[model samples]
Target: MEQGQAPNGLSSCYRHPGVETGVRCTRCERPICPDCMVGASVGFQCPECVRNGSGTGHGPDAARPRNIAGGAIAGGDRQLVTKVLIGINLLVFLGGLFFSGLVDELVLIGLAFDPELFRVVGVADGEWYRLLTAVFLHQEVWHVGFNMIGLWVLGGPLEAALGRVRYLALYLLSGLAGSALTYAIVAPNQPSLGASGAVFGLMGATFVLFRRLRYDLRPVLGLIVLNVLITVVFREVIAWEAHLGGLVAGAVIAYGMVSGPRGKRPLLQWGACALVLAATVVMVVMRTTALV
Candidate 1:
């Protein structure tokens, strides 16, 4: 017999008695078919074990450990989301290498004529997706390298601390906030692209997180000051507005995530993120109205 095949009627799947299987659930030790197997850190788990906390050796009533932001602490890779984000940016960067015109279509622009499209198109022209696509787009090696380094260094801790969902929300909202501010302030024809805004946002969030954990603030504070100085000095090259917007948005969101009463923590935390998102939308709408 094969490794996973059961002899005659020696073993059968618990969920499907007619089907024979040698594989057993790691948690409940019940024979399970491929359909009922759920991947786990160790071996496969049955549907029931996966649904409940039994796979972790805890009953439904067991109090699971939670991170600072009220997210359940689970085993396995903590920086999965961050890794995915980096992979996305790298894939986009690779695509740009092959498709030269991709940059024009994805780069952040309020209003401008695309040479490749040979038409006037931009955020004001209803292609608002550029704001987000531009977040993952990068052309130069140096540009992507610096941003990825920042992301890997800053994002891992943030994702582990805040949990994947909340950390992702913080990143996307901060990026959108940066884009909105850039659109509102920068010249309509001026094109901008990079993850600098999002990286700056992470820096801001880290500042708040350190404070919350009662860690020393001088290191983060100094870093922020240095970056601000760099932004000001290179205002012509860097989009200062984006950096400023992301920093403010990230700080505000982080404060909400880490602060407030424990009982109402989820409400207050998500409410704060919602407010930032709302504000970002308002900024974009206002800018679009003015431009169009």
Candidate 2:
């Protein structure tokens, strides 16, 4: 029974309530209207199934899916991570300075990852805290300044994407991972300071997230490589191992938290992050126990 062409029993197939269509089923020559149309690269279907046989093309504006490649994270959730993190790191840096008798070297030396300190402590060790503390401690004035600037640049976007809690998690986790890696590879007597580890991790996370989202990677990868090279050549004071560790950790964490078209399940992502943290702790333990 033709729809509108009917009298009472049959409703308007072209504009029926339960008909469900969209435009036309380009294949069957049926009047599909709105609810019954299934969009294909070529044309709409009769909702029944994909028309592998259909040969026509949908017009230029065929309800295309969002590009979603470059949009901000967490759908741009409200956040204040950039401000708060900066403030906290700065405060810690100041405290490290004052507590160490306002001596620049003392502040840098005291709070930084001092493997010797970890080896000799009260009951267990005080060196373990250095890993967590070093991330928040900066040596030179310019050190904190540069770190803050970069932190502001990256934190705004990622915090918005991952929410404040998750963003902080990434920063800390990455820092921890970077420190752990350094301990695992390098001698502990080396006193490493600066938020370079956390910062590198942020870069890593951004790189992975953007690539997964399918944006231009040339910009991100190039920028990260360039900076890392600069750090190696010009900044011997830089803890290369900590930076490397943070980058790897942040990238791994970001992989799990990011969502939408190319994200992992939430539970899976959280679990992965937990595993990374645990692994970092284990590595730190090994470093402490080792003689070198």
As for candidate 1, its clashing pairs are none
User: Which candidate wins on lDDT?
Assistant: 1
lDDT of 1 by residue, 196-288 (tens): 788888999999988765457899899899989988998888888889888998998888987775558799789989999999889989999
Span of 10 residues, lowest total lDDT, candidate 1: 54-63
The whole-model lDDT of each prediction reads 0.83, 0.64
Question: Which 10-residue window of candidate 2 scores lowest in summed lDDT?
Answer: 64-73
As a whole number from 0 to 100, the lDDT of residue 103 in candidate 1 is 88
Instruction: For residues 90-134, write the lDDT of model 2, one tens digit per residue.
Output: 997778666753223322222233343333321014446666766
lDDT, residue 44, model 1: 62
